[model samples]
Target: MQPAAPESAAPAAFSYTAFALSLIAGLALGIALGRLLGPLPGGEAEPWQLRAEDRNHYMLAIALEYHESGDAARALDKLIALKPAGDPLVALAEGACALGSGGYLADASGIAALRSAVQLYQDFGREGCAERLLPEAAPAALPAEPPPPAADARAQPTPLPSKTPPPASAQTAQTARLAPTPLPRRFREHSLRSFCDIARPAIIEVRTVDYLGRGVPGQRIRVRWGESEDIFLTGIKREYGDNYGDFQMEEGVEYAVDMPGAAEPLATALSTGSCYSDNRRGLKSWRVSFVEV
Candidate 1:
């Protein structure tokens, strides 16, 4: 079935930059790279490289995430020894770099160069070139120093005020039980960074027909995000299809809202790989004003 059009109350403006991820998975590389790159053990870049070409995109991705979250210090630290990216991922990095630079990304053309980098990698059939290049990195940090000798070993440590007074394990369990469980959104899944703050909320379910209006299971359903990009979270599980339905969403999140005359929340959210994806088309992605209980 066709997915509804994308809509948003606050249109998210971002660069459509792409980058070559290492043929290696991000999780695998984090183990050693953290130390090798002068960081605490167990961090980003899993399945990381000990080779060149493979290291570029994954490094770029790490840099981008840090840049977007406004952690310039960390992002710069990662890119300190890295080379300028080529193709596909270069564009992706450019977008993240712009965000890292502390300047407003007024429009999509904001990081067009970065997007081209991702395309470059793809064009060369090195979609995930696994290059682990390490021409040189700064020297590792010094080991931590031992604590200073104390005046009296027998003295009891000063009592510290508890934060929130520690909750009893039993009480904590009870509170968890009382909280509303997040019913799984069967279609929630994403490949790229899905923007939870900007998207349409109209959730669409697709079902195939066997001549009867019954339900068709196991059909490929496409939910496109917005005009800015042709991102569609495709090949969803069929169980959720029968309910081509509406479900209320958490407030302060993006949604493809339900059509007033339609069955559910207007397809008001964009598609996250997991329920909502962030698509920036330079339109009205926000509400002028509205009251809600």
Candidate 2:
């Protein structure tokens, strides 16, 4: 029977299109499974990746620890690990201000300590508004010494000591007279100038200094526009003078600048109107200064 027609031996041809479709389907299934499983192990967020508020808290904790241990290097290392966008010192100081402004320092000795630690850094040129938000802590009251044990009534009383006024001298009088009470220091506007430049955009630049004209770091500056307000501190940008701080201004908007306890705003309303420089029109810029009076 013709060898049963050789059993019709013939292999089925492979479909390249079917292979490609199967490959694509497998890849998609793998991706879906990965999504359902979430991130792989050890994928925890880094300390630098913490949320902004959490990062502030982290900075405060570091400052408090630094206060207790006085380990500035360790504290600095820890702060650097946070990967702050600005100076670590400034970040620390801002954290202190945030804590104080947020009412987180009420009866919180730890937070107060953190603020004190930040102030110590301020002396080194690190600047922030912490001092305005949180004043220095008052000294603790000294304990009263116990009165000498009363002499026993039975013991004979000693003769009363003579009370004689010593001869008055210039030194004695000078010592006795209380030094004239010093007047409280206040800051007054030193200078205010406005200009424009094509290269530099509009800004409110503020500088604070002592009576001696020495740049004072860590001074707080407040800027209000519309209903919004912002505070900044000097010395945050060391490249600029330690007393230098700046705020960018939006075109056609007015802003008020002030400091704590000032009689009034430094600039009741500083308008960012147009100005000409180098024969080219541009937004206006301001340079204002304050000095201790």
Residue-pair clashes per prediction, in order, are: 77, 0
**Per-model lDDT:** 0.33, 0.70
Query: Mind giving the per-residue lDDT tens digits that candidate 1 earns over 199-293?
Result: 45423333233333343222222332333211121112223443132232333344443222111332345432333335534222232111111
lDDT of 1: 0.33
Candidate 1 accuracy as TM-score:
0.15
Q: Which candidate is the best by TM-score?
A: 2
TM-score of each: 0.15, 0.46
Candidate 1: segments with Cα more than 4 A from true spot: 1-49, 81-293
